[model samples]
Target: MDLQESFINSPDHHRIPLLSWAPQTPTAVLVIAHGMAEHAARYQPLAQWLNQHQVAVIAVQHRGHGPHCPDADLGHYADKRGWQKVVDDLQQVVVHARKQYPDLPLTLFGHSMGSFIAQAFTQKYGDQIDNLILCATNRVDKPKLRASLVLVRSIKALRGKRHRSRLIDNMTFGTFNKAFVPNRTSHDWLSRDPQQVDRYLKDPLCGFSCTAGLWSDFIGGMLDINPRVWRKDLPVHLLAGSCDPVGEMGRGFSRHVTNLRAAGVKVASERLFEGARHELVNETNADEVWHHILNCLRPETHSVTE
Candidate 1:
């Protein structure tokens, strides 16, 4: 694998660190939107595997994430218009990809929080991408999202935008781990693979709580996504874990697909792993997931959830 490192200048002059894995004469290029609280390095194995198949990979460390965070504080997006900036940051990545891998088909692969960013990107720039893959995504109820914003606002008013409130953190992610009682780690819901779970727990940048303002921005972005009015003629592939609590144990994922269909996605495909959890890319059957993803490039959308 040929690895390259560079820095992209965001609209606001933020220095966004980029990681690339390229194979000579690539077939396609993949621009990755990584999940929240984790950097782009975690996706190295997947990138390396894709390079072997002649698919190049490019990923960026988001505004408030990774060791090279240049603008916002750790666990925080900007205090205002943070979500929109995150979306813009993604666009910057796409722009970089277009120039770096010119004339190649591009796919946007987003996981968890990055899925929300990717969804918003498709809504804003549907004409730019060739394919969209949303993994571990969910539908957001508008009412709950509004209430969450209210709570985040109240907390921010009291604790400040940069404050890391345990109350807010627990309110957001506390229950996901409960699905697996007698758990060995707090992020057991991330994967069934113990080594992967341990890796996340050990990484300093993996599981930190975001600030109140960042939560407000994230949920605001979610509110903008669900029931979103957008149309695209491209293939959209949805992937998730059957028992993943983030999607409310699969109901939320279903609603998201329904929403996308209602919003006029031309070809939509879905697949759920029976016993898998969040972070399908890091799960034990990750190779299968990767192969399944490659199969989707053929432009056939299936309704079956196998």
Candidate 2:
């Protein structure tokens, strides 16, 4: 596998870091959008696996993630227009990927919060992508999300856009840890693998709280994307861990698929991994998850090799 790192200028003038893995002759290109509180480097395992299958992988560290994006602080995309900027950053990466692999089909693979961006991206740029892969995704209840947004907005108004609110963080993520009572870490819901959970807890950039404005923007964006009419012709593959609290233990994921179907999306596939958690890619059975992802992207491909 060949690895390369480069920076692309986003619409907001922020330099976004892109990590790429390529094979000598690529069959397709996958543009990966990582989740919140995490960076693209974590996807190296998946990228390498794709490379083995003659698939090229490009991952972007969204603004406020990793060490890139000097303009934005950790856990904060922007003071205003944060979610839009994240979406714009993804589009910029897609444009770059197309220029690099003009002939090969391109698939957009998004995880968690990134899935929300992918959903919104398809609404505007569905023609540009050949397939969409959403992992650990869910549909937001408008009423509940709006109420949370109000609280986040009020916090932003009082504490400023950059202020990190523990109250908000607890309200948002605290219940997730409850599912794994007597757990070793607060991020136990992230994965069943203890090592994976430990790595996240040790990483300073992994579990930090986001600014109130960031949360407000994220909820707003979720509401905007969740209700939009998706393109019926687009092929969408949704993956989730049945143990993932974010997906409401698969119920929310099913609801999301149902909603998309209701909106006339004709080509959609949903896969629920039993006992897997939020971070399927980092779960104990991650190789199985990867195999499912590969099959989704390239149905003709051979079985995953050990």
Candidate 3:
């Protein structure tokens, strides 16, 4: 089925926009949140792909990102202060969705920055979700790094309150360099797929630099919330690339999965792809990633009844 556009008024009084796609026989619902600067519409292909497989999808625009954004510099997410606000917004969206489709199993999928929010949301609303997936996220360690982030972000947040730039560039993805980065850098350092990178560049809504405030808020949120808090109670799946920058050295993004396991969280599984980049969902081997996700949607010995 084709996508249908809709909007919900935020409890805080913002206009929240969302897009939905329904298949003929729906098996489950997947709600997606796009990364920083980008809006939910970027997931059009993924949503359509899910719909073709009988999975309904609802991609919600983060507060500052899409039509809801009041300022060009601030998309669905602002900074740490607004991070929880974004999480609350996501919770509200999920609750609203549950009310609308009480019969459908609900799962949440977040990529990059969205993954950070997804992890926190899962912690806040673990009982509400049937399954949770996070892609291209890292655990926050090193208090020194956190301190540096906080210090830098404080300056940005102060500036954002008064004079903030309308456009912000993000170095998280950095420039696609082969030697300094991975092979996927040839296509797009962030994603392993050249076609996907090409499409992202061509799409006006796909790429934008995040603000200093956004970065600070993200770092604060990361430090404040430990995935371990929600790791045990939630059925979570994390997918990351071994060679990806996030997992480079002492960070040990994969080791964090084991930490989650220790906390007693039912980690459905954690997959580490060899040459994948940050955006595994947009990578050349994304088909393989898609298959793994489908498996999460349909666990072994469990069949879709409808």
TM-scores of all candidate predictions against the true structure: 0.94, 0.96, 0.86
Model number with the top TM-score = 2
Query: Residue 197 in model 3: shift from native, Å?
Result: 1.5
Candidate 3 on 19-105: residue-level lDDT in tens? 888898887888887787577877777778878888888888886687546666454264336778888878877887787678988
Cα displacement (angstroms), candidate 3, residue 245, comes to: 1.8
**How many steric clashes does model 2 contain?**
0
Kindly list the per-residue Cα lDDT of model 1 for residues 22-58, writing each as its tens digit: 9987888888999887889999999998887778999
Judged by whole-model lDDT over C-alpha atoms, candidate 3 comes out at 0.71
lDDT, candidate 1, at 231: 49
Worst 10 residues of 3 by lDDT: 162-171
Q: How many angstroms is residue 293 displaced in model 1 relative to the true structure, after the best TM-score fit?
A: 1.5
- Prediction-by-prediction clash tally: 0, 0, 12
Each model's lDDT: 0.84, 0.87, 0.71
Q: Candidate 2's residue-wise lDDT over 137-199, tens digit each?
A: 997788989999898889989999988998987886788888989978888999999999999
lDDT of 2: 0.87
**On lDDT, who's better, 1 or 2?**
2
